[model samples]
Target: MVDAFAEDEEPISLPLHASSDEIGRVFNEHAERRSATLRASTERAIRDHFAEAHDGQEPPERIMR
Candidate 1:
Protein backbone atom coordinates (compact mmCIF):
# COMPACT_ATOMS: atom_id res chain seq x y z
CA MET A 1 0.00 0.00 0.00
CA VAL A 2 2.84 2.37 0.79
CA ASP A 3 4.44 1.67 -2.52
CA ALA A 4 1.12 2.06 -4.25
CA PHE A 5 0.67 5.47 -2.67
CA ALA A 6 4.18 6.48 -3.60
CA GLU A 7 3.57 5.46 -7.15
CA ASP A 8 0.37 7.42 -7.30
CA GLU A 9 1.87 10.62 -5.90
CA GLU A 10 2.98 13.12 -8.51
CA PRO A 11 6.69 13.85 -8.56
CA ILE A 12 7.67 17.33 -7.42
CA SER A 13 10.79 19.35 -7.87
CA LEU A 14 11.70 22.39 -5.79
CA PRO A 15 13.39 24.87 -8.08
CA LEU A 16 14.85 27.98 -6.59
CA HIS A 17 14.10 31.28 -8.24
CA ALA A 18 16.24 34.45 -8.06
CA SER A 19 15.18 35.49 -4.56
CA SER A 20 15.66 33.30 -1.51
CA ASP A 21 12.91 35.05 0.39
CA GLU A 22 10.47 34.49 -2.43
CA ILE A 23 11.45 30.83 -2.51
CA GLY A 24 10.87 30.51 1.22
CA ARG A 25 7.51 32.21 0.95
CA VAL A 26 6.46 29.92 -1.85
CA PHE A 27 7.52 26.85 0.10
CA ASN A 28 5.71 28.03 3.20
CA GLU A 29 2.56 28.71 1.24
CA HIS A 30 2.71 25.28 -0.30
CA ALA A 31 3.11 23.68 3.11
CA GLU A 32 0.23 25.65 4.56
CA ARG A 33 -2.08 24.66 1.73
CA ARG A 34 -1.11 21.03 2.05
CA SER A 35 -1.65 21.11 5.80
CA ALA A 36 -5.09 22.62 5.35
CA THR A 37 -6.08 19.99 2.84
CA LEU A 38 -4.94 17.10 4.99
CA ARG A 39 -6.65 18.55 8.02
CA ALA A 40 -9.95 18.81 6.19
CA SER A 41 -9.71 15.34 4.69
CA THR A 42 -8.87 13.68 8.00
CA GLU A 43 -11.63 15.55 9.78
CA ARG A 44 -14.18 14.28 7.30
CA ALA A 45 -12.87 10.74 7.50
CA ILE A 46 -13.01 10.73 11.29
CA ARG A 47 -16.48 12.23 11.35
CA ASP A 48 -17.74 9.43 9.15
CA HIS A 49 -15.90 6.77 11.12
CA PHE A 50 -17.02 7.90 14.57
CA ALA A 51 -20.57 8.60 13.50
CA GLU A 52 -21.11 4.97 14.62
CA ALA A 53 -18.78 4.70 17.63
CA HIS A 54 -19.96 5.30 21.16
CA ASP A 55 -17.33 7.80 22.35
CA GLY A 56 -16.52 9.00 18.86
CA GLN A 57 -13.96 6.97 16.97
CA GLU A 58 -10.53 7.25 18.42
CA PRO A 59 -9.36 10.59 17.08
CA PRO A 60 -6.84 9.99 14.38
CA GLU A 61 -3.27 9.91 15.60
CA ARG A 62 -1.71 13.31 15.06
CA ILE A 63 1.66 11.96 14.14
CA MET A 64 2.91 12.03 10.58
CA ARG A 65 2.59 8.25 10.56
Candidate 2:
Protein backbone atom coordinates (compact mmCIF):
# COMPACT_ATOMS: atom_id res chain seq x y z
CA MET A 1 0.00 0.00 0.00
CA VAL A 2 2.87 2.36 0.79
CA ASP A 3 4.11 1.95 -2.77
CA ALA A 4 0.81 3.27 -4.07
CA PHE A 5 1.31 6.79 -2.67
CA ALA A 6 3.78 9.52 -3.47
CA GLU A 7 6.64 10.42 -1.17
CA ASP A 8 4.70 13.30 0.39
CA GLU A 9 1.44 11.39 0.74
CA GLU A 10 0.68 9.27 3.79
CA PRO A 11 -0.53 5.71 3.55
CA ILE A 12 -3.98 5.06 4.91
CA SER A 13 -4.64 2.32 7.40
CA LEU A 14 -7.77 0.48 8.49
CA PRO A 15 -8.35 -1.59 11.56
CA LEU A 16 -7.39 -5.19 11.02
CA HIS A 17 -10.95 -6.15 11.83
CA ALA A 18 -12.67 -3.25 10.10
CA SER A 19 -16.14 -3.98 8.78
CA SER A 20 -17.27 -3.34 5.20
CA ASP A 21 -19.17 -0.22 6.23
CA GLU A 22 -16.12 1.22 7.94
CA ILE A 23 -14.00 0.65 4.86
CA GLY A 24 -16.62 2.23 2.64
CA ARG A 25 -16.83 5.26 4.90
CA VAL A 26 -13.08 5.78 4.77
CA PHE A 27 -13.04 5.59 0.97
CA ASN A 28 -16.02 7.96 0.70
CA GLU A 29 -14.37 10.56 2.91
CA HIS A 30 -11.14 10.39 0.90
CA ALA A 31 -13.04 10.77 -2.38
CA GLU A 32 -14.95 13.78 -1.05
CA ARG A 33 -11.75 15.57 -0.04
CA ARG A 34 -10.12 14.83 -3.42
CA SER A 35 -13.20 16.05 -5.29
CA ALA A 36 -13.30 19.32 -3.36
CA THR A 37 -9.64 19.98 -4.00
CA LEU A 38 -10.03 19.33 -7.72
CA ARG A 39 -13.08 21.59 -7.90
CA ALA A 40 -11.29 24.50 -6.24
CA SER A 41 -8.29 24.08 -8.49
CA THR A 42 -10.46 24.06 -11.60
CA GLU A 43 -12.29 27.19 -10.47
CA ARG A 44 -9.05 28.98 -9.84
CA ALA A 45 -7.74 28.08 -13.28
CA ILE A 46 -10.92 29.29 -14.99
CA ARG A 47 -10.87 32.57 -13.09
CA ASP A 48 -7.25 33.15 -14.00
CA HIS A 49 -7.92 32.48 -17.66
CA PHE A 50 -10.91 34.82 -17.73
CA ALA A 51 -9.02 37.58 -15.94
CA GLU A 52 -6.15 37.40 -18.39
CA ALA A 53 -8.42 37.36 -21.43
CA HIS A 54 -10.54 40.26 -20.12
CA ASP A 55 -7.72 42.61 -19.10
CA GLY A 56 -7.67 41.66 -15.43
CA GLN A 57 -11.47 41.83 -15.04
CA GLU A 58 -13.98 39.04 -15.35
CA PRO A 59 -16.13 39.07 -18.48
CA PRO A 60 -19.93 39.20 -18.37
CA GLU A 61 -21.67 36.10 -17.04
CA ARG A 62 -23.32 35.30 -20.34
CA ILE A 63 -20.04 35.42 -22.24
CA MET A 64 -18.48 32.97 -19.80
CA ARG A 65 -20.61 30.20 -21.19
Candidate 3:
Protein backbone atom coordinates (compact mmCIF):
# COMPACT_ATOMS: atom_id res chain seq x y z
CA MET A 1 0.00 0.00 0.00
CA VAL A 2 1.09 3.54 -0.54
CA ASP A 3 2.12 5.40 2.55
CA ALA A 4 -0.47 7.74 4.02
CA PHE A 5 2.37 10.03 4.99
CA ALA A 6 3.64 10.39 1.45
CA GLU A 7 3.83 13.84 -0.07
CA ASP A 8 0.73 15.33 -1.58
CA GLU A 9 0.43 16.61 -5.11
CA GLU A 10 0.55 20.31 -5.80
CA PRO A 11 -2.58 22.31 -6.46
CA ILE A 12 -3.82 22.96 -9.97
CA SER A 13 -4.22 26.42 -11.40
CA LEU A 14 -7.76 27.75 -11.39
CA PRO A 15 -9.16 29.61 -14.37
CA LEU A 16 -10.98 32.88 -14.03
CA HIS A 17 -14.02 33.04 -16.31
CA ALA A 18 -14.35 36.77 -16.91
CA SER A 19 -13.21 38.59 -20.00
CA SER A 20 -12.11 42.20 -19.62
CA ASP A 21 -15.33 43.62 -21.01
CA GLU A 22 -17.53 41.23 -19.10
CA ILE A 23 -15.72 41.82 -15.83
CA GLY A 24 -15.76 45.55 -16.35
CA ARG A 25 -19.44 45.54 -17.12
CA VAL A 26 -20.31 43.47 -14.09
CA PHE A 27 -18.20 45.54 -11.79
CA ASN A 28 -19.52 48.78 -13.16
CA GLU A 29 -23.12 47.71 -12.89
CA HIS A 30 -22.93 46.14 -9.45
CA ALA A 31 -19.84 46.76 -7.37
CA GLU A 32 -19.28 50.08 -5.68
CA ARG A 33 -15.52 49.48 -5.82
CA ARG A 34 -12.98 50.68 -8.34
CA SER A 35 -11.01 47.87 -9.98
CA ALA A 36 -7.85 48.34 -7.89
CA THR A 37 -9.73 48.63 -4.64
CA LEU A 38 -11.92 45.68 -5.51
CA ARG A 39 -8.86 43.53 -6.04
CA ALA A 40 -7.39 44.58 -2.72
CA SER A 41 -10.64 43.89 -0.91
CA THR A 42 -11.01 40.48 -2.50
CA GLU A 43 -7.49 39.55 -1.43
CA ARG A 44 -8.10 40.77 2.06
CA ALA A 45 -11.24 38.67 2.33
CA ILE A 46 -9.45 35.53 1.27
CA ARG A 47 -6.67 36.16 3.75
CA ASP A 48 -9.13 36.78 6.50
CA HIS A 49 -11.03 33.59 5.78
CA PHE A 50 -7.88 31.51 5.85
CA ALA A 51 -6.67 33.17 9.00
CA GLU A 52 -9.91 32.70 10.85
CA ALA A 53 -10.33 29.10 9.80
CA HIS A 54 -6.81 28.13 10.82
CA ASP A 55 -6.47 30.29 13.89
CA GLY A 56 -4.65 28.73 16.87
CA GLN A 57 -4.81 25.34 15.27
CA GLU A 58 -2.18 22.93 14.05
CA PRO A 59 -2.96 22.23 10.43
CA PRO A 60 -1.97 19.16 8.49
CA GLU A 61 1.31 19.42 6.62
CA ARG A 62 -0.75 19.63 3.49
CA ILE A 63 -3.98 20.90 4.87
CA MET A 64 -5.67 21.71 1.60
CA ARG A 65 -3.89 19.10 -0.43
Candidate 4:
Protein backbone atom coordinates (compact mmCIF):
# COMPACT_ATOMS: atom_id res chain seq x y z
CA MET A 1 0.00 0.00 0.00
CA VAL A 2 2.91 2.36 0.64
CA ASP A 3 3.85 1.86 -3.03
CA ALA A 4 0.49 3.39 -3.95
CA PHE A 5 1.77 6.75 -2.68
CA ALA A 6 5.32 6.23 -4.02
CA GLU A 7 6.52 6.44 -0.42
CA ASP A 8 9.11 3.74 -0.78
CA GLU A 9 11.74 5.99 0.80
CA GLU A 10 9.68 6.20 4.03
CA PRO A 11 8.98 3.12 6.02
CA ILE A 12 5.56 2.61 7.61
CA SER A 13 5.59 1.09 11.09
CA LEU A 14 2.53 -0.73 12.39
CA PRO A 15 1.85 -3.33 14.98
CA LEU A 16 3.07 -6.71 13.81
CA HIS A 17 -0.42 -8.12 14.37
CA ALA A 18 -2.26 -5.29 12.67
CA SER A 19 -5.46 -6.41 11.00
CA SER A 20 -6.56 -5.62 7.43
CA ASP A 21 -9.20 -3.21 8.71
CA GLU A 22 -6.65 -1.37 10.81
CA ILE A 23 -4.27 -1.03 7.87
CA GLY A 24 -7.01 0.21 5.61
CA ARG A 25 -8.11 2.79 8.17
CA VAL A 26 -4.56 4.06 8.52
CA PHE A 27 -4.08 4.31 4.77
CA ASN A 28 -7.37 6.18 4.36
CA GLU A 29 -6.57 8.65 7.15
CA HIS A 30 -3.16 9.32 5.67
CA ALA A 31 -4.60 9.82 2.21
CA GLU A 32 -7.19 12.29 3.47
CA ARG A 33 -4.55 14.34 5.29
CA ARG A 34 -2.32 14.39 2.23
CA SER A 35 -5.23 15.43 0.05
CA ALA A 36 -6.12 18.32 2.34
CA THR A 37 -2.48 19.50 2.44
CA LEU A 38 -2.13 19.38 -1.34
CA ARG A 39 -5.38 21.27 -1.79
CA ALA A 40 -4.25 24.01 0.58
CA SER A 41 -0.87 24.31 -1.13
CA THR A 42 -2.46 24.60 -4.56
CA GLU A 43 -4.92 27.21 -3.35
CA ARG A 44 -2.09 29.23 -1.81
CA ALA A 45 -0.11 29.13 -5.03
CA ILE A 46 -3.10 30.27 -7.05
CA ARG A 47 -3.82 33.13 -4.64
CA ASP A 48 -0.18 34.20 -4.77
CA HIS A 49 -0.20 34.24 -8.56
CA PHE A 50 -3.37 36.28 -8.70
CA ALA A 51 -2.12 38.65 -6.05
CA GLU A 52 1.03 39.24 -8.07
CA ALA A 53 -0.92 39.73 -11.28
CA HIS A 54 -3.17 42.28 -9.59
CA ASP A 55 -0.35 44.14 -7.84
CA GLY A 56 -1.14 42.55 -4.45
CA GLN A 57 -4.89 43.07 -4.82
CA GLU A 58 -7.33 40.24 -4.60
CA PRO A 59 -8.74 38.99 -7.87
CA PRO A 60 -12.40 39.28 -8.81
CA GLU A 61 -14.78 36.85 -7.13
CA ARG A 62 -15.99 35.62 -10.50
CA ILE A 63 -12.48 34.84 -11.63
CA MET A 64 -11.73 32.98 -8.42
CA ARG A 65 -14.85 30.92 -8.79
Best by lDDT: 4
On lDDT, who's better, 3 or 4? 4
- In angstroms, give how far residue 10 of model 4 lies from its true place: 7.4
For candidate 4, lDDT tens digit of each residue in 1-65? 12335532334567889999999987787777777766677678788888878785757664553
**Cα error, candidate 4, residue 49 (Å):** 0.4
User: lDDT of all predictions, in order shown?
Assistant: 0.61, 0.68, 0.54, 0.69
Every model: Cα RMSD to truth = 6.2, 6.1, 15.5, 5.6
Give candidate 1 misplaced runs (Cα > 4 Å).
1-17, 55-65
Candidate achieving higher lDDT, 2 or 4: 4
Q: Who is ahead in TM-score, 1 or 4?
A: 4
lDDT of 1 by residue, 1-65 (tens): 12333333434345645387767776677667666766677677677767767474566666775
Off by over 4 Å in 3: 1-33, 56-65
Indicate the TM-score of model 4: 0.67
In angstroms, the error of model 1 at 39 is 0.4
Q: Model 2: per-residue lDDT, tens digit, 1-65? A: 22222422535679999999999998788767766766676677778888887785756664454
Top model number, TM-score: 2
Candidate 3's residue-wise lDDT over 1-65, tens digit each? 33322422333333398687877776564433344455666667767777799897654443445
Error of 1 at 42 (Å): 0.7
- Candidate scoring better on lDDT of 1 and 4: 4
